[model samples]
Target: MKYLLSNLKIDINNKIYLKDPESSDLGKRIIEHSIQLIDDIGFDSFTFKKLGIIIGSNESSIYRYFESKHKLLLYLTSWYWAWLEYQLVFSTTNVTNSNEKLDKAIDILTRTIESDSTFAHIDEVTLSRVVINEYSKSYLTKEVDDENKDGYFSIYKRLVTRLHDMMIEVNPNYKFPHSLASTVLEGALHQHFLKNHFKSLTDCNQKVQPSDYFKHLVFNALDTKT
Candidate 1:
C-alpha cells in the first residue's frame, strides 16, 4: 500500500494545484488528506471539522479555499477527472495509429486500477450508494450530466470518443456504438462496485478481475471488423 501510494504521487504534485503556490500546495495536501479520510470514514462521515483536524488547519482556514462541503466535493471530483485526463493523454496522445490509441486507453484503465489506492478501500456497494447520494445533490448532478462536455469534460469525452471512433475503424459491423458502450461500461462499473456485497442467485464468475475484464470486454466487443 505504501509503495502504491508513492508511485501514484509521482506526477500528482504539479497537476493537483491551481496557481498560487502556497494555497495550491495547501489545497493539494488537504486533498490528499481528504482522500485518506474518505477511504477511512466514508464520504458520509467526512466533514470540514474532521479534515481541519487531520490537516492541522482550523475549519475557517479550510473554508477559505472551499466555501462548503459540496464545493470541496465538486473540486475533488473535478480533480479526479483532471487526473484521469492527464493519465490518458500522457499514455496515448503521442500515438497516431488508431489501434495503438485503443491499447493506450486500455493501459490507462488498467494502470489506474492497479496503482491508485483511492478506490482500494471502497467496496462496490458503498460506491454505488455514494453515486446515488451525489445524484440527489444539485451541483453534483450537474457534474454527472456534464461529464461529456468537451472542455471541462475533455478528458472523459476524448477517451470515450476516441475509443468509439477506433471501434468503428476496427469493425464497421460492430453493433454497439461508442455511446452505448460508454453507457454499458459505466453502468456496469457502477453496479459492480455498488452491488458487490449482495449475494447472487445466478452463478457468475466473481473471480474475474474488473480492470482486465473491462479491457477484454472492450476489445472483444469491438473486434468484429479486425
Candidate 2:
C-alpha cells in the first residue's frame, strides 16, 4: 500500500527530538522561536537561555524538548529533508513522464523556498537559509558517526535515494546515481553560498533559474545532455 505523506501533516522523526515538539503549543513555540533566533543570531552564538528569554520561558524549559542546540539544528535539518521529500512525492504523484518528473524534482529541490500554509509553524524561507548555511555543520562533528548510526541522516538519505531512482529510470545504465544525486543537493547549497560570497565563480543565479541550471547539469551527467 502507498502512503500520501503530504495530504496530512508531515511527521518529523522522533529520534531527533528528546520529546515531540509537535505535542504542545510551548513545544511548537520552541521550534518556531528557535528558527527565528538562529536566523537572527548565528548558531554558535545561540543558546537555550537566549532562546528562552526571547520566547518568555525558562532556559530549562527549553531543554524539555531539545537536549541541546545541536540536536535542535539536527531536528530542523531533518524536518527540512522530510518536508522536501513530501514536496517531491506530492509534486510527482500525478506525473508519469520520467524526464518531466525528474525535472520537477530538481526544480523543487534546487529552487528557493517560500512559506507553505500547510505548515504554519515552519517559515520555510528562513528554514531554507538554515539548511543552506547550517545544515552541513550539523554533521561536521566528532559525533557524526554515532549520530549517523542513530539514524540522524535517514531522512536526507531517503531524499537522495528517491531522486537517484528517478535518475536511474532516465538512464538505466547510469553508474553514479548516488554520486549524482548527492552532488545535485550539495551543489545547489554551494551555489547559494557562492552567489552571496563569491559570485563570479558560478553562474547559478545568473540569467537562468538555478533549477534550470541544475536540471541541465543532472541531464548532462546522465549523458542525455538536455
Candidate 3:
C-alpha cells in the first residue's frame, strides 16, 4: 500500500491555496513547518509570521502559497481526508462481503493514526492530531457557506458518501445511512478528542478504542451482526 500510495498525490482544492505547496521546496517547507508549528502552539496562536521565522523565510513568501492561516488549515484538513479516502478505497476494494467491507471502512475511519512514509515532509500522525484538535475551525466560520460552494469540503463530503454507500450495501432497509455515515466520521474525531482531553467523558481508553465503540454502534443500528 505504501508503494502504491508513494506514486500518488493527495489532491486538495486549488482555491484553498494561492499556490501549490507541493510544487516547490519553499512551499513544501511552509507546509512541513506549519504543521509542526501549529501542533506546538495550537491554531489560535499560529501565524504566518511565526511560521516564517521557524522556516527562515519571509512572511510574504508564505502568503504566496496561502492567502491566510485559515486557508492553510483547510489545505491540511482536506489533504488528511483525501489520504484517508485512499486508504478506505484501497483496503476495501477487494472485499466481497458487505459486512466485512463496512467493518474495514469503520476501522479505517475511527482507528488511531500512524505516520505514513509516503509523504516524508508531512507527518500524518501529527497532522491527524491537528485535524482532531483544529478541524472544526476550518469550517466553523461565517465564510464556510461560500467555501463549501467553492468545493473546499468536497474531499470530506466524498469520504462520508463512501461510508454512506457501504452502510446501504450492508443494510438496504436502513433509513439513515447518510446521517449514520457522517456520525461515524465526525463522531470518531470527537471521541478521540474526548479520550485525549476529557477522559472522563468517554469510555474509550487503552483497551477500548473509538473504532470498537463505533463498530458496535453501527452494527446494532443497522440491525446486523458484527
Candidate 4:
C-alpha cells in the first residue's frame, strides 16, 4: 500500500509538477526529514512512506516535491553540497593570514567530523556508495563531468585547492598538491567518522573524539616532508 508524504502540492521543476516557489519550503523540510530519518534508521531502510509519516505528510504530497525516492536523494546530495559551501565560505573568506586560514579550515573540518548535527551520523562508506551510484549514471549536464572527481570529490578539490594556496603563502617551503591535502582530509574524516559508522569499525574504545584526531592529522600533514 502507498502512503502520503505531504498533502501540499510542490513543483519539482524538470519533473512531473509545475514550478511553484511555495513548494520550496515544504520541499526543504521534506529533505531535511529524509536526512533525519536516514540517521535514525539506516539509509537502506529509509523510504518515502516513512518520511511522510515522520513529516506528517503523505506520499502524494511528497510527489509534489519529488517524483521518486531517487530524485529526493539527488536533491539531498545537492543540499549537502550547498551546506558545505556555507561552511567553507564562512570558515575561509575573512581570514587574513595563510596559517590562520589553514587553522580555520582544519577547525571547520574538525567540527564537521565531530558534530552529528552537521553530518547526521551518516558515514563515509554509505555516502561513498550513494555518490558512486549516482556518479555512474549519465549526467544530463556537464556539472558532473569527471567519473572519479565529481560530487564530494569536486567539493573537496575546491576546498583543498584554496587551502593549499594558503599554505604556500604561509610557508614558501610547502609544496604539495591540492589532491594530496584533499585526500588527507578525506582520510581523516573517513577514519574518524565515516568508517566507524558504515564499516562498524570503531577507532577508539569509547569516547574517542574526531576533533582530537583531526588536530593530530593536521599537524602531521603540515609538518611532514611534502
Candidate 5:
C-alpha cells in the first residue's frame, strides 16, 4: 500500500478547470465539498451556490476553479478514472500472469470502492457512488464532442486501453479486447445503478458478487477457461 502515500496525486485534464483545485487550500475545499454535495443531492441539483454555502465560500470563488457545474462534474469524473488507473497500475505491477492481471483489473473495476487514505480531501467511496449514479452526465451531453476534443476523456480511455492490451497479451487471436474491456467497466456501473434503484435488473446477492459475473463474462467472451 505504499501507493497510498500522502503525496499521491491523480492527474486530471487541465482543460476542465480554470485552476488546479488540488494545488490550493480553498480549491481543495471546493473539491471536497463538491463531492459531498453531489453525493447528497445528485449532480443535476448540485450547484456552486449551494456548494458555496456549505464550504463558506461564495459562488464566485468556486467559479474560479471551474467554469460551470458541468465542468466540475467533468473534473470529478475525470479525477475518478485517473485515480482508478493509478490503483490498477499499483495493484498489477507485481503480478506476473497475464490472465491473473486481467482478472485483477476486472475485479478493481467491478468491486465496491474504498476510500484511499492517501488523498486526505477525497472520499473515494462517496465519489464512487457519485460516479455510479452521475458520471454519465459528464459525457452524455451536447458538448461531449468539444469535451472529447479537449482531451477530457483520455484517462478513462487510457485505462481501458491498458486492460485491452493485457487481454491481447493473454490471447493474441482475441477479436474484441477493446469491446470486452469497455463492457466490463460500463456494465459494472450499470449493474450498480440497477442494484440501487431497480433491484429486478440486478442480482446483488451475498454470494454472487458482480466481479464473479464480470469475470465469467470476460473469460467466456475471450473463449478461455479460467
Candidate 6:
C-alpha cells in the first residue's frame, strides 16, 4: 500500500489554482508554507504577503500560483479531500463484507489524522488541522454557488458519494444515505472543532474519539450490529 501510495498524485480542480503547486520547487514551497502559515495564523489572518515572507519570495510570485488566499484555501482543502479519497479507496478496496467496508470508511473519515510521509513536501497532519479549523471558509461565501458549478468541490462531493454508496451496500432499504453520508463527513469536522474549543458541547474526548461516536451512530442508524 505504501508503494502504491508513494506514487499517488492527488488531482485538484484546475480552476482552483492559477498554476499547479506540485509542478516546481517554488510552487511546492508555496503549498508547504501556506499550510503552515494558515495553521499558525488561521485563514482570516493568512495572506500571500505573509506567506511570501516565510518562503522568501515576492508576494506576486505566490499570486502566480494562486490568485487569492481564498483560491489557495480551495486548493488546499481540495487537495486534502482528494488525498483522503485515495486513502479511503485503498483501505476499503479488499473488504468483502459491506458492513465492514462501511466501518472502515467511517474510521478513515472520522479518525484523527496522522502525517503521511509519501507526500513529504506537504504535511498531512498539519493540513488536516487546517481543514478542521478553516474548511468552511472555502465555501461559505457568495461565490460558492458559482465555484460549485465550476467543479471546485467535485473531490469533496465525490467522497460523500463514495460513503453514500457504502451506506446503500450496508442497508439497501436506507432512505437517507446521501444525507447520512454527508452528515458523517461534515459532522466529523464539526465534532473535532467542538472537541477542541467547546469541550462541553462534544462527547469526543481523550478516551472517546469522533470515529467511535460516528461508528456507533451509523451502525444504529442502519440497524446493524457493530
Ranking by TM-score: 3, 6, 5, 2, 1, 4
Which stretches of candidate 2 lie above 4 Å from their native place? 1-7
What are the per-residue Cα lDDT tens digits for candidate 5 across 1-226?
Answer: 6456445767888989999998899999999989999999998899899999999988999999999999998899988888888778889999999889989988888888876777889899999999999988889999899889989999989988998987897888988888988988888888888877887877765567788889898888888876
lDDT digits (tens) for residues 152-214 of candidate 2: 999898999999999998998999999999988888888887776788888866566568789
Give the per-residue lDDT of model 4 (tens digit) for 77-150: 44443344456666678778666676666666544332323333334334433443342232343645452253
* lDDT on C-alpha atoms for all candidate structures: 0.53, 0.86, 0.95, 0.52, 0.87, 0.93
lDDT of 3 at 169: 94
Residue by residue across 8-60, what tens digits does model 1's lDDT show? 53222222233321346666667667666765776668898999899888877
Worst 10 residues of 6 by lDDT: 1-10
Per-candidate TM-scores read 0.62, 0.94, 0.99, 0.59, 0.96, 0.99
How many clashes (backbone atoms < 3 Å, residues ≥3 apart in a chain or on different chains) does model 5 have? 0
RMSD of every prediction: 6.4, 2.5, 0.5, 9.0, 1.2, 0.7
Question: Which parts of model 6 are misplaced by more than 4 Å?
Answer: none
> Model 3, stretches more than 4 Å misplaced?
none
Off by over 4 Å in 1: 1-22, 94-97, 110-112, 116-155, 172-176, 184-188, 191-207, 223-226
- Give lDDT for model 2: 0.86
Per-residue error for 18 in candidate 4, Å, reads 9.1
Pairs of colliding residues, candidate 6? none
Residue-level lDDT tens digits of model 6 in 102-173: 999999999999867898889999999999999999999999999999999999999999999999998999
Instruction: Give model 2's TM-score versus the native structure.
Output: 0.94
